[model samples]
Target: MPLSTRQSVIIALIVASAYFMENLDATVIATALPHMAATFGVTPVGLSIGMTAYLLAIAVFIPISGWVADRFGQRSVFGGAIVVFTGASVLCGLSNGLVEFTVARILQGVGGAMMVPVGRLAVLRSTEKHHLMRSIAYITWPGLAAPVVGPALGGFISTYFSWRWIFLLNVPIGLLGLALTATFIPNYRASTHRPFDVSGFVLSGVALICLMYGMELVGQLHSDWRITVAALTCGAGAAALAIRHLGRAAHPLIDLSPWRIPTFRVTLDGGSLYVVSVSVSPFLLPLLFQLGFGLNSFAAGLLVLAYAAGNLGMKSVTTPILKRFGYRNVMIVNGLLTAATIAMCSLISPSTPRVLITLVLLIGGLCRSMQFTGINTLAFADVPPARMSSASTFFSMVQQMTIGLGIAFGAIALHAAVLVHGNHAQLSLADFRVAFLLVAVLVLISVLYFIGIEPDAGREVSGHTRTASR
Candidate 1:
């Protein structure tokens, strides 16, 4: 049965809430690293294992999500995912050592890998064509807002309360999501099922894990460049092999047919650029404040509030903007502005007025929100209903891979600047400037892709008609 409007709304809300819990769990650890390290008796960098393990686990499992959900009912898998994630969160909060925590994180990743992609699949299946833009916008906020505010929120909690609360807080949210899922989310499975592609899963998992972990390696300032290069090379090769196999295999784990769709293809290309570039700001901005401007953790996190505020502040107007300007125009213009705003950071230094900095970040956030909404809305507009699950899985995998790539690229930019300038000591403002400029250039490349999008693209989803004046 096609979902009624109220039912669709419930599904979107339930899925968004679940994703918020998942994303918040993934991101909130950013600011609590110091406290966690102290308690675990390790360097701050050493604690990254917890984060990387979770990411690698997610990347490894995400490719199989669609198939798994199709084999089992979505309701069963979704509920199980929440249970696993929530239980893992509790275990993470209780961990006393790095090994224990890393293990728990991987378990959490198993749940999250299933949780996010399947939830998205549910929304795509339930939402009507006309309401896709709003449903997509609803789901996207948790993905954006959680990461944006996670550092600040984490810093506050760790400073005043305990880092344990970061994970423990998920219990209630997860319970609520689980309850709502049972009441509101419908069970769905593919009618025609094929044998599981164990080899494909193996190859894709290896590719994603190596790529993401390699990036994590690149981020470590003191790591061996040789190992980093090797891991990245292997990741590239495995990815190539995986793609070839998926394209050729009759029962491939990941169905790649959806990439043939022009709208989906272009959105992926353009979205990758935005993801890689913006990925830097979150990791870089807090550091720039702390290392360059000499702000403490609490103050640095608070400073990032401007960026987070900017990220969320534009949400209310995104739908209207897309409706008025259309997806293509908004993406090209808004994406360019977002990139430009990132480059504008080069102008910020110790002497820059605080208010001016906040204003710039606020504007940047607004631009980014609009760009993401346009891309996400337009992505699924042309996808066939039968292929929705496959499209969701492929899209999620791409997002995971590119975000990992962005982090690595951000790390490399900083490392490159440090090496070039012979700043063998502390990172100076000059290093951050180099990183920002390079990443911004990467973002500008996305505009070239966006230019190729046809006029009146995604009109049905955005309600933008060719006859109407902007």
Candidate 2:
């Protein structure tokens, strides 16, 4: 049975809620690490083990989320994910020691790995082809709120109240989302039972965990180089094995054959690059304002709110813009604009007017939001119906890798600049300039990928036709 209009909207919102909670939890701890570490009687740096644990849990489990959802059922698995996430959040808040907190976070990461992709599976199954673009836009645009809100909210809560409240606050949101999900999200699953690919799962999990963890280690100033090298080499070996197995396995965990599709390939190769750069901005911007500019956390967060507003404000215009200009053009133009805005950040200083700084960030947010929605919609526009689940899972998994790399890349840039300066002094504005410039150049380079995409490439989803071309 086709889902009704009202039901479809509700379903999209439900997925968005899960995505929000997941993104929020991922970022909120950044601002509160000092306070969190104080309670555990450890240095802030020592508590990075908890962060790494959470990320590792996510890497190990996400590759299987789609298969698990298929095997069990979407609604059941997604609902269970919410329960685990919510319960784990409570545990995180109540944890009294570093070990306890790390364990809780690992549990939370398991929930998170399923939370986004499974919810997405439901949406992709329920929404119609013609309505796909609009439905996706509805779900995605709202979740952008999490990254911006997480930093500000974490800073506010830690400053005014308790850091634990950050975790506790999700309790109510998760419970409400769970109830609504049970009421609305349809129970969709594949009819035939596919044999589980145990080898593929293990190989992929090891590959991702080692690769991401290695990337994180490389970014740390004190990390051992030999360990980083070993982790990266092992990750590469494991990934090669996984790819070989996937090619020969009957019913592999995910089908990389989707890469043959031009849209999917560009999205995977090019879109991943853009995500890495954009992801760095959230981590970089707050540090720029708070550390480099010597602003209080509250003030820095207030400034970041401009970027959030720009992100949200672009939602109303995104669909129409894609319809008007088409994916290739919009992605190329808006992408460059986004890169320019990021480069513009290099020009900001304590002497720069607050209004000017906000304006630059706002424009960057708006452009990046359009680029994100466009790439996502186009990636699926050409995908066959049968492969939707696999495509969604694969894309989401790749996104997780790049998002993790983004923050680490930003950290490495900052630390590298500090090293070059040969100073024990605190991070200066110049270090941030170096970081922003590096990432922005990467973003600029990705624009060339869109040039390879045909002008009419995503026409079905974009509703862009020759007769309507401007």
On TM-score, the leading prediction is 1
Global local distance difference test of model 2: 0.87
Compared with the true structure, what per-residue lDDT tens digits does model 1 show for residues 61-173? 99999999999978889899999999999999999999999999999999999988999899888888788887887788788778778888998999899999999999998
Q: Which pairs of residues collide in model 2?
A: none
Error of model 1, residue 283, in angstroms = 0.8
Candidate 2: list runs displaced more than 4 Å: 419-425
Q: Which stretches of candidate 1 lie over 4 Å from their true place?
A: none
Q: State residue 421's C-alpha deviation in candidate 2, in Å.
A: 4.5
Candidate 1 least-lDDT 10 residues: 461-470
Per-candidate Cα RMSD to the true structure, in Å, reads: 1.4, 1.6
Compared with the true structure, model 2 gives a TM-score of 0.96
Model 1 TM-score is 0.97
